[model samples]
Target chain A: MAKGSLRINEISNAANVLLNVIFILLSFLCIYPILLVIGTSFAEETYLNVVGYKAFPKVISLDAYKYVLSNAKPITNAYIVTIITTLTGTVLSTLMIALYAYAIVQQGFKYRRFFTFFIFFTMLFNGGIVPWYIVCTQVLKIQNTLIALVWPYLINAWYVMVMKTFYNTTVPSAIIEAAKIDGASELKTFFRIVFPIAIPGLATIALFMTLRYWNDWYLPFMLTSDPKLSNIQMYLKRILNNLQELLNSSSAAMQAGSMLAVVPREGARMAICALAVGPIVLAYPFFQRFFVKGLTIGSVKG
Target chain B: MVKTVVKQLKDKAIEIKKKKSFFKDLHDNREYLLMIVPGVLQLILFNYLPLFGLILAFKTVDYSKGFFNMDWNGFKNFEFLFKNPDVFTVLRNTLGYNLIFIVTGAIVPVAVAVGLSLLKNKTGARAYQSFMFLPYFLSWIIVSYLVFGIFDYRLGIFNNIISGVFGREAVNWYQSPRYWPTILVLLHIWKTFGYNSIIYFAAIMGIDSELYEAASIDGAGVWKQVLVITIPSIKPVIVMLAILAVGKILNADFGMFYNVPMGSGALMPVTNVLDTFVYNALKINGDIAMATAAGFFQSVVGFVLVLVTNHIVNRIDSAQALF
Candidate 1:
């Protein structure tokens, strides 16, 4: 077993080829589901009603999209709500988290440990949804408002901690000291000097914030009472679950029987799925670079 | 190191106080302290305040009187969960699905990371990664529809494939409980393995290439090198991920259990866990007390499990212990 051999190299090369084939097959499997949804969404709803969705469509139609777009008001409204919330939420969450993270990392700050524990404690225990719902509705009076969509997610404990670790390790002390030597205010140093250098880390957190706000339906579903304020994901879930459209079939037998009776909804469901996933797919490559850099630096966020 | 730094920090503060005015040091850092105000305030309002609402778990809310006037009924609130008729089914599904996820969660990521690492072409690896990462970027709502698209019995791709291949009737996937556990596991793996693999892939990348070189020089075959080199190189990351996963074993992802099954009453046997059950109860009755009880039950059980797990991990290996 001591001699380095040509035969083993040949075998390894062959094995690499086999592995490549397996991964390509696996990659195709991953790509195919999303394609099926996209293809079916464009396919005539009747074709799926006859034979279901296909990996590749036999016929093409835009009826599902047309049906969805016909309800253009709600879709546009939800999209607007999602867009506003995503933009506002990511910016605010990233800023506040970076600020807090930077504050805690400074050795001169006396309460850093206490503040760290204060934020960290919330991660370990939560009051669950009922009370959270109560506070948001009863005390804060956020329900049925646009604010409800963005308010709850403004700061996540995990992201705050990640940014804290990022600042602690990456933003060197020498930079802050150099700025202080010039009589720069703490705020001045942070904004003018430190924040620029920390953009990569901030962008990483921003990517997470953007995705969460874009994809979140839970916050809206629980916090907001107004359908006008509902996000797109909730709208999709509503369509998927609202079996009441299956006629006056309140009975269990009829409900189950009538599930297939709601055939058009299947195509509509895929259309909505595609609609919801569309923006994320378009925007992901921009965030793709930050993902590897951020995750590698602070991989514990999960 | 954290303690040593804190100790030195206190010593410096004391010496600085003796040399200068106390207000000077406090004045120096007040801006930094001010920076933290919004974060602390938001956290207290959102995260910690709800912790105070955990008291509702012990109370029967009387909306006429508000939260302050709610009746303290002792453990009577917990009766909602422990006394529910579906208690066994809900517990079974939550624990069962979570266990399956834990096992798959450990194995699938490592497998993907190893497989991806073996690729020679960076472009192809990146493309494959993009495909895998695609599903993770999508929300559960979209994922549910994507899954339903394939399993829609009458019009689903799976039924058509089987029927076309086997000349058999399409199975009604939604109504049938027999296939869900497998389907759910497969979906769980599919949605997650891509993201999880990246963590292990990063760890694998960090392993010394020299070890692999040494192994190849010793005439190790690909399989042997992978066994002795790649897997062992990523062992710590694998163990860390597994330990963290075990901490969350009692808690199921609500979106997956709720949305992905389309919340079919027929499939609830296999799908309804504590989160969805509590959600349904709250949705129907608006009974804050009962809902809090369920929530509290999940949190308490999950908390205890985490503690026990961390303790065991601490005993075995202190560095990997979460605390």
Candidate 2:
């Protein structure tokens, strides 16, 4: 029996080693492509043409970065647009969702069921894309503007549902009752007592909204034709679609004649990609925990 | 008789209080009512109003006539949609790809989650998870750049390997339709498996360790333990995910379909799904009626699928049902 057990232990140990190797390879697969992007960004433009994108730079150069920075007007504008939208959109959406969710959860609020059902009904059905597009462009008249990006995504039904779940679990009814008994008004009770306690939940939702706003190209692609209003994602998309456009319009000075011979076409494109995703990639670890927490809680119930 | 009269009077007073409570409740929770006004208005503008706009599907919309007033064209829009042979191809690609995604999406994540659970090195597992989760943060636009870098005919990584290693002519991947289905599914998995795996991993974590210990002591091996205990424990999560996928079977991730292929015209036969189809019809072809009809079709079917899936799940496990 001892010998048989020893054999089994040996087999299990081998299996464990095998599992580790497999997972490490999988992890490498996940991360290697990003490394390729980063590598190609630093690569010399001439070398990039001769040798395709590699896991490391073929010949190290900062020409791409210099080129991108020298013509900083569009990139700067896009960055500003992205930042403004992310901050304002996240704050507004989180507050609106929290208020709406909080109102529905109040025990004494007579229209709680009606209000809850109103949002929940959206989760089951929508009038699809065409009608929604018409509503935005025609009726709301929000096309080709900053408001287009912010307004449409302000109240996702799923986010509201998740916020409702978060509020139900996090903010105990007894605390609200205690605040009410102490003569706190409904808004006061929420702002003073409940809001402090609901910060973690709100933070999770805020992070999600931030990511959504930061990463969205769809709203810009659909709503705006103007280059000035394009966010970072949309800007990157424009570059990806037409590298020749970027090469031709290197700078206003360069646009006077054909100076495409020296343009870092390949390197500049990857550099822009690297720049666009740099913030998210760096800040990922800090926010990833909250995302996991939100996912677990949100999925377990809903 | 006097007692009965008094009781009847008391009941009448209670009835009147109940009747008056609507206004009383309105008066009482007026603060909360004020709180939800902005959200409700936004919801009405964005969500509810669009339902009314589904009328555009049945109408021959004229820009000069305005949105609210249009000629009733009956089934003409839908007829235009169905008459196009391209519609069947798009429909097939949408359903086929989604069905494949549903299967692979369920299996791969669960497998990764289970594999992570089995590892003895907790730190290593966490590192693997973080690395995997990194891709989810990338927008489809950025991912398109990565895909382009890999698939660009002259300078792409794949072309380098193909021509350099095999001594063959470098193929233009952009022009190829046959390779797209595989490319798309793999890309979808690569982008999403990390996030999806985390959900399953959390579910696996929730399972009691004692059950595993008990099975081990019963001389069940790792594989047996997984088959007998771990999978069954997380069955509800697997089922719930599958049902949700089924609910959205008609819908494709529009960004993935649009961006990854880089809008290459040659790849349209394989890459075009319902969302992209509607988009092309509306934007490129300027066929508003046809687009509206397709969008309306998707909405009604998607809504029914949700209801049907929820009903099925409710019958099986009420706790796991989305509703």
Report DockQ per prediction, comma-separated: 0.42, 0.50
Q: In model 2, state the lDDT of residue A253.
A: 22
For candidate 2, give the docking quality class from DockQ. Answer: medium
Clash pairs, model 2 backbone:
none
Per-residue C-alpha lDDT of model 2 across residues B141-245, encoded as one tens digit per residue: 998988888899989999999999998899899999999999999999999999999989988888777777777788987788778987998888888788778
Positional deviation of residue A76's Cα in model 2 after best superposition, in angstroms: 0.5
Per-residue lDDT for A133-191 in model 1, tens only?
88887789888888888888888878887787788778899989999899998899999
For residues A76-185, what per-residue lDDT tens digits would candidate 2 score against the true structure?
A: 99999999999999999999998998899888888999999999898778898888888888899999999998988888777777888888887889998999999999
- Candidate 2 error regions (>4 Å): A1-11, A250-261, B1-20
What tens digits encode model 1's per-residue C-alpha lDDT throughout B23-98? 7756776898789888888988898887788888888877678878888999998886688788789888888888
Which prediction has the highest DockQ against the true structure? 2
lDDT of 2 at A127: 91
The TM-score between candidate 1 and the true structure equals: 0.88
Candidate 2 local lDDT, residue A295: 82
**How many angstroms is residue B145 displaced in model 2 relative to the true structure, after the best TM-score fit?**
0.3
